[model samples]
Target: MAARGEVSTGVSADSEPEPGWLPDAAIVLSGGRGSRLGGTPKGRVRVGDIPLLDGVLDAVSAAGIQRAVVVGHPPSLERAGVVVTREDPPFAGPLAGVAAGLLALPDLPGKAWVMVLACDLPRAGEVIPLLLTGSPAEDDGAGVARERVQGADGWLVVDDAGRRQWLAGCYRIGPLRAACAAASTEGPDGLVGLPLRAAFGRLHLREVPDPHGASADVDTPEDLMRARAAARRSHRERMES
Candidate 1:
């Protein structure tokens, strides 16, 4: 997209125009079945004495995500007022959830920034807005943040041991939609591993390893405990600061 952190209106810096005052919009990816956690809806799992999804919603709201749509089953998503959805055809995991969000398009309530975030993250505060860093304007349908890492699998930025989380990622509506459309034609299974790597290799894109501390996500019970400890430490540090 537009140069990392360097925003404008159009695709290029010079073409960047004034953006419309978008209200605020988002997509909470709550469609996972948490198969690794014994089919438990990870979004509904409690953490920090609150439902995991609640922790995520709090961050999105904190970052100004006023109008949001959730993707998941009703029983799995008890969060009120969140417009819920499901994985579109081909049911190709999280990508479909994101596609459903992109399909919502300009129709999103308030017509604002359509951010997509997952519920299993350790913290969502810092990374919420960091996703919008590459945005040219508030409504130019721009921006995308590379999850940040230190190696070539650098794409494996926030992986815990081996699980490569993707839904926790975010992107602006423009390039995101293009990516989805391209993925759709080739079918779902073709978007990961070698194929996925090749797809990203062909884009005229910018990679930013600027993920915030909140980017970490927990999968196992041990991971959960670590996340809680981390959160507690962060709170203590913030208060002291």
Candidate 2:
């Protein structure tokens, strides 16, 4: 597994394999201070007419995900067909959000695959199929349990710039639960302040390339502007087609 914040370059090409099943649910992490955006929740921020949360939910829905947990308390997201919940103590970070998501699930044991995404990305939905398609190969080990335990767990997107987007991925539920458990114990806030890379260290990951930049997300006013412009362009293209 890759260390916290380390960009991995050596994940074997042989690990890529076709998905055997569709994702059962999604955990959309939405509880961030958006401190750079001056305390505005990124999920509530708009790129054109749609809030970021709506866009993410739309993508999740489009991917055929029946259930979704938005790990934040945005009224808009609750109305967007997601189960809205917040990390304990509020703003406990993405790892804690993951823990909350797992707990909120009614049948965590029944789910085989769960998509995990950040709420800030306008195009977050577009990358989900890529994650689903780039699952770990069966030959990686003799058994599913053996492969995952040996670190072949899930699929994460690597952006065009070659940075790993931890929030834009799909994970096997059992391994994800284990990883979240390990990650949540690393901090006082139930992994509230722990960086994503640390949590990622607990799993074996396969990198799915983000060829269309679908993992691009808003972190600042300038990013919002760009996202809106891109949304406009995409809308225009769709209308023209």
Candidate 3:
């Protein structure tokens, strides 16, 4: 088992705050099987003029996350540009990919927030700031877990709300690493899904408005179409600006 907590690059957080934001790096989880797309690599799919991973990387860039660690599957990781890695055990699922990312860059010297992202999202780029802002630091190794309202209210809130989107989470790598390692027992089911919850029951989750960008993913062809339209709209706004 490869210790996924090894940091070997410049992605580490520095002692001084470059600007006003907490220095951090994004560990994008892009190794999932786009089952609805006939097993196509969602990261390669075009969302507007750029590939899915491009949009994700841009989002991380905009958030002041200078460095990125992409954990993709097979040739998907072979893409040119940016720092990329692959799943430790190939297609073992998103958890495996996430673990690979955590391992690839451990002890980010200056970074505090490790934004975990999925590649199938169409609007994640526009919606990540909301999660990064106002999020509390995990003074302890627990982490900043989001909680929402009651389950009956729906599965979106950030608090201990009977609802939450575990995948679209951010945290300090220390606790997250320990939690993930402990959750390894659950295999793919662990990590950002159920096992993560089990390991860190007392996580510090914050609640947002349940932005669709953080929740929606391009799974099926219909989803792709929707994502394309959204992406085009965003691109147009940027071009006009």
What TM-score quantifies how close candidate 2 is to the native fold?
A: 0.80
Q: Model 3, 1-241: lDDT tens per residue?
A: 1112222232222221112343256777777677778777888888787788777777766665666788875243433334778875567666667677888876563224566777766667655765544333332322222232111111112433335555566555665676667777765544544433554444444445443445577778998888788777877999999
Number of the predicted model whose TM-score against the real structure is largest: 2
Model 2, 73-125: lDDT tens per residue?
67543444468888887977777788788888756563256778898988765
Ranking by lDDT: 2, 3, 1
What is the clash tally of candidate 3? 22
Give the worst 10-residue stretch by lDDT in candidate 2.
4-13
Provide TM-scores for the models.
0.64, 0.80, 0.68
RMSD of each: 7.9, 8.0, 8.5
User: Model 1, range 14-133, lDDT digits (tens) per residue?
Assistant: 222223222245677776677776777878776667777878888766654456677665354444446677765423466677767666555532212345677787576665654544
The models' CA-based lDDT, in order, is 0.52, 0.71, 0.58
TM-score, prediction 1: 0.64
Clashes of each: 3, 2, 22
Top candidate, metric lDDT: 2
